[model samples]
Target: MSEDAPTRADGDRDLFDPNYRAAVVDLLGALAYSELRAFAQLAKDSELAPTLGHTSALAILAAHELRNFKLLTDRLRALEVDSEEAMQPFVEAVDAFHARTTSSNWLEGLVKAYVGEGIAQDFYREIANYVDPDTKSLVLAVLEDQGQADFAVAAVRQAIEEDGRVAGRLALWGRRLVGEAITQAQRVGVERDALGSLLVGAPGSGGADLAELGRMFVRLTDAHTKRMERLGLSA
Candidate 1:
């Protein structure tokens, strides 16, 4: 990941670069909607919780997603972009991802929240490196991993400790989540040129080459694996 992002010294000139602006808007929009959907899904999944304590924890997690969604939407508005309009292009793809990865049980839902959200955050953080400093800061801020890691690991490990059989099923579930996430991401890459430009360059900027993109994938995959391991689940 490049830390040599254009500083404020580059001034507003780069901000006015149409391609960069479009790409950033597209990125923000996709993130905004993803957060929004995560909140909705988390809220719904909270109902499947076995106890009030678990339900409350899941609701808190949903709130975190909503907060990130608000940050992204606010950024979009500051750029004079309609948040909904910007997110429109990604609606179907994101929706499709969640639809295909729906969980059949409470533990599966938790695993999805842990593994799926972790992967999405990793991918966005990777792309942030290629963007300007301001955008990179916002992306990083919105992606703060929070305390979900500890919660996921404790809950999952406890479940596995109680019933060793669950480990095998959840390991497969984690793999399915990774696969579906990759499928949707590739679909979006092919369908959204603006988002794709983040990897290959918008127009003027020398964006990541094929090798760089490959490395980015490796980073995301490695991060996902670690996240799954943290949850006591297989990647």
Candidate 2:
């Protein structure tokens, strides 16, 4: 998000421009708050776990998210941006996403966690490609899989093996998660011009075009499908 960085390969140079630097800070703040929120939700969901082992596993995942939050906030501080101010703009939309997609049970929570994280990682990674190398590294690092996938997949698949009927319901829940995510994403796009500019580029900057954004969503959806399949759920 630093304005001192060189232009990117596309010559967009959003990273080095003051206006775009604010956008980058906005993006980082959103990501930072996201990790923190996920941490809280994961901790709350752990209470629904049927076993002590499941509880401990979820707690570990929550810790990983907390660590990611710290990383993001540290970067924001270094950039001299107030992390909370940067995150403020996107808070309502993000909260609405979780509010609408709240899980009804432990299995549903697990599926939501797995699927949601997968899609989000795909998205940020796509955006990172346009950013400075250092910023991109931080974004990718924050999105890195922290052992949550294997645990969620194994737990979910084992549950389905035990009670096959659950798959149909969980599959529906998976679809619901995707739907809510898409809806919220559109909302974010409308509400955050800075973030939208990161995707579509500034008016004259020749950033990512519509076709590129389409392709990025395709990649994200494909990744989401694979993650759902791994969980023995339909996407």
Candidate 3:
């Protein structure tokens, strides 16, 4: 099997369990909404580009996000879940996350696009490990990085090189974005029991326990730190 393909075990058959199915639906719904929001936000942020080349790059990234959104919603439909209805529960929390982390300028926007989204994708990828094989594959595919990381890193690093002061300011912004992302993630897990149960381990849910969840956060933090380093900023 390809390295990118999900490893299948006999346990993957648990996908048919009603509880596991519901959890997968909730996961797909949340992912679908996130992709849609990314598309809109990337398009808006493209307006902050300093040059036509930057503008075109961000526009391409925005298009990728829209395509990813369609992939997720299509998966939800195949499960017989109403895409909009499934996504509705997460709208408020996700919107609030963006509202709290709104960027003040082009560089800040680049940092958020890289750091904020990176942490969220890391968290989802970790969770994917606990799901059935097919659901795991879908989640991994949707969460794949789509060139935004490289673009953001190059842009932010160049800015920092041009103005040393840019590093300090962007470091602070990166910290705020990570904190807010964590808070919003916790809120979602609290409000959405099915999603939470995937980590907390509902009966027959085959989810990770509390210990695993703690370690998951550690991995997330490490990833954020590396991302910050790539941007020429502190974590």
- Each model's TM-score? 0.92, 0.92, 0.93
lDDT of each: 0.83, 0.82, 0.83
Rank candidates by TM-score, best first: 3, 1, 2
What are the root-mean-square deviations of the candidates from the true structure over C-alphas? Answer: 4.4, 2.9, 4.1
Q: Candidate 2: worst 10 consecutive residues by lDDT?
A: 4-13
Candidate 1 per-residue lDDT, tens place, 1-235, comes to: 1254334464333656777778888889988988999999999999999889989998998999999999888888777788999999999989999999999989989888889877887878877877877888889998897777777788889999999999999999999899888776666665778778878875567578889888877887898888888877766
Per-residue accuracy of model 2 over 179-226 as CA lDDT, tens digit each: 777666666655678777878887765468889888877887888889
Candidate 1, pairs of clashing residues? none
Better of 1 and 2 by TM-score: 1
Give me candidate 3's TM-score against the actual structure. Answer: 0.93
